[model samples]
Target: MAGAQRLAQTLAGRLDTTFTKVGTPRTPLDADWQAQLASALPELRQLAETLTLRLVEGHKPLAVLPRCAAALATLPVIARHHPDACLIWLDAHGDLNTPASSVSGYLGGMVLTAAAELWDSGLGSGWRLDQVVLADGRELDQAELALITQYDIRHLTSESLTPEALSQAIGNRPVYLHLDCDLLAPGLMPTEYSVAGGPDLAQLYALCSAIGHHELIGLEVAEFEEQPDFAMAEAAEALCDALAPVYERLYR
Candidate 1:
């Protein structure tokens, strides 16, 4: 929780935006737990009143998925009021699954599905699946893979994405890029819970450039743990550097 707060502070400071931090206790993926999560909706809505700068509580990987979906559901409405908006998802997993089909039963893995409306009963309803761009997911389950294949969503895997490919994939969309620190190589970003291979620094920079040059509504970097070998502060700084140019152009 502290680490996420720090990251949010760092990101807001670098981007010259305000940041709001919220917290959620770890909960299981049961009916009671979902109710516990649903209770936070009011606070989430208030925090999202204006996107200038805000950070809500996110913990427990599984719970984070539902929370993210719920939050994202509000975005399209926000976008309707303020049109130009798109979503860029950065992670190691696709987060696409229905509750029944989730083998691991990890709710975080089902976040994208909620956003995509693949999940049966979570996340109120928001943008269409076409609005999201899954960036740098290298690990995916068979079920998740099938969903991606069926939807034909635009995604760039960590192994296959070059800076060039990332640039092309994003094209020119007004974007809300979500960076799950796990999308970095294990050595580079050890704070992440799961580290399957991810994009290198160079590719990441290129992708950020594309994102910044295009219309970016906002950005969210999640799932950064504080580990002995990991320098969360340094990683945050590097991310700020990568995004500096984008802000420069946007503000210029």
Candidate 2:
């Protein structure tokens, strides 16, 4: 959370616009978690419409992402202005495993499926699996691989996250960028979920530049720990530097 807050501050200093903090729900996720998020939707939506750039910082529990996605969908800008806004999910894991197919039963692993809710009972949100573009996920589980094949969701491999390919994936829709810190290469980012063989720092900056120049409605950087190691600190600094251009592009 401190990392995110610091990033927000950094952006505030560099960019022409101020970074407004859109508060996340404090309630612990339980059976009524969806309802809790829904009740908070109006306020979130208002902020989305009002603020130039809203940076949402959180622990980013996968179980709560579906609810978060629900609230984001209701953002008056997305719901009213850009109805065709799609999600760009940058992560190391596929996050497509369902409870039945999951081997580890980790809630974070099922985030994309939960957000899309294409199979299970949905959070009554607008996102569908078809509207998501998954990038840089090399740590996919067997079940996730099977599900992606069955659903035909666009999975952009590490080799495929190039500028031309990303442009094609995004097409004409505005984007909601969801960046998991673990998307960085294992040694680059010291998050709990870091995986090897992901994009390096140069590729990461290029990736950010590619999609960020497009129509971006919102940005969320998640899974940052309250306490970071030396490697994590370095990684976070690099991320902020890369995104400085993205922040500039938002106004352009």
Candidate 3:
């Protein structure tokens, strides 16, 4: 979450606007994942209401969240506000596991599934599977693969990313882009959980540029961690540079 704060501060300074933090945990939770989620429901609901108000006020959203599990809050707001919107999910894992199928019992890995109503989150409604697009998922569990094949979910590899292919993936619906920082190749950025191979910063820049051409509703960034040696504010500037096109389009 340090990385997200640095990024938000940098962007807010550049844009001459202030960022609002909905709430922060006073201390670490000494409990299991489900209990942690239960404790966090109030704050998550606050975030959902904030986004809903922005969309209702006709402002496009660009959220920098500490973790992807927070999507269990944000995704529903986006999906409900724009029923025809398609989420272009760019992540390192499928995040498609149900409570029963998840081996690690990590809530972040099942957020999208929660967003899809595969489980009742008590936050809000779920997204339509047909309006979803998964991209750059290099590490998928066997269960996730089965879910993909069973649902016929659209999955795009990094090698095939291009303007045409991206547009094809998004179809004619308006776009909501979710990016997990781990989606980048390791060593290029600092993230809590990164695997071996994925797209580089240049590819990320290109992807943002191409998606800028679409009717974009929002951008959600998650899982960026802090590295003491790597300057946080400097990394934030680089990220903002790569995201320049989409930010320009959204705030234009």
Candidate 4:
């Protein structure tokens, strides 16, 4: 089982979410896979129609966000209502590497670029790179660093996520939140992609709590790998607790 499913199950048990499982796309990055993603998009669009805070689970951040872009393309309602939606990308790495810039060539590393490119084509009506607040991004690649400087994407460094800062970054815009569990400080748990010197759980949760003041549209949590002895459970619990405010706002 993928860690995402386990995390979703655990979160469903604890939160007010309704669970729906979907197949993960296995095709490579090509036209065929892009077509498949287009077909798969409506599932999320249907969920978005409900106008509730939806929890999306995926094995990798790449698996979710790119597909989400496709889904968003079909959701005119969301676009009409949230034309100014901003993304709060919580990850240790910038996830801004293009295919030409990535050293590791990990598809997950290229997800942000893929999503950005999709939006560039006006696919999802998604937020632009400048609209993203990259919280706890400490493992940025050199290429990502250069691009971030060029684009001036905001990197969130406050010990606690401040509503003013968040508001300043993207004022009065609905938020689409993404959390990569790897963003947690080292040794919190065994994440699939670990980086050093990130925020601990307490600080991370504080950020989530601060997000409650915004109009949150959706959330996706990825990059959590299951561990033995309930360690993964503990980690998921911490995430759920931190996101409690957003969850409550969405659920209500």
Candidate No. with top TM-score: 3
For model 4, residues 1-252, the per-residue Cα lDDT tens digits are 256677777667765544665556354445543454455456545444443333222111112222223333323333345566677877777778765776765545655665556323223444457777887677776888887888888876635445566557756777777777777876785565777677777766667777777777766766666566547767767767877776666655
Arranged by lDDT, best first = 3, 2, 4, 1
User: Total clashes, candidate 3?
Assistant: 0
Error of 4 at 171 (Å): 2.9
Off by over 4 Å in 3: none
In candidate 2, stretches whose alpha carbon ends up further than 4 angstroms from where it belongs are: 16-81, 119-123, 231-234
Query: Candidate 1 at residue 237, lDDT?
Result: 76
Candidate 2, which ten residues in sequence have the lowest lDDT sum?
58-67
TM-score, each model? 0.76, 0.72, 0.95, 0.73
Write model 2 residue lDDT over 1-252, tens digit each, in one string.
355555566555555445545555354445443454456557555554443232333111111122223334333333344457777878887778766777766555656775555434232334567777888788888878887887778889987778789878999888877777788876665456777777777777788788876877766566654354455445556777765545556555
Model 3 lDDT tens row, 1-252: 666777778777867788878777456677766988998899999999999999899999989888898888999999888888989988888889888999988888988888888888778766867677888788889999998888778888667766678878886788999999998888777787988988888888988988999998989888876788776766788788888878788898
Candidate 4 Cα misplacement greater than 4 A, ranges: 24-81, 118-125, 158-164
Please state every model's RMSD to the true fold in angstroms: 5.5, 6.1, 1.4, 6.0
**lDDT score of residue 24 within candidate 3:** 74
| Pairs that clash in candidate 4 | none
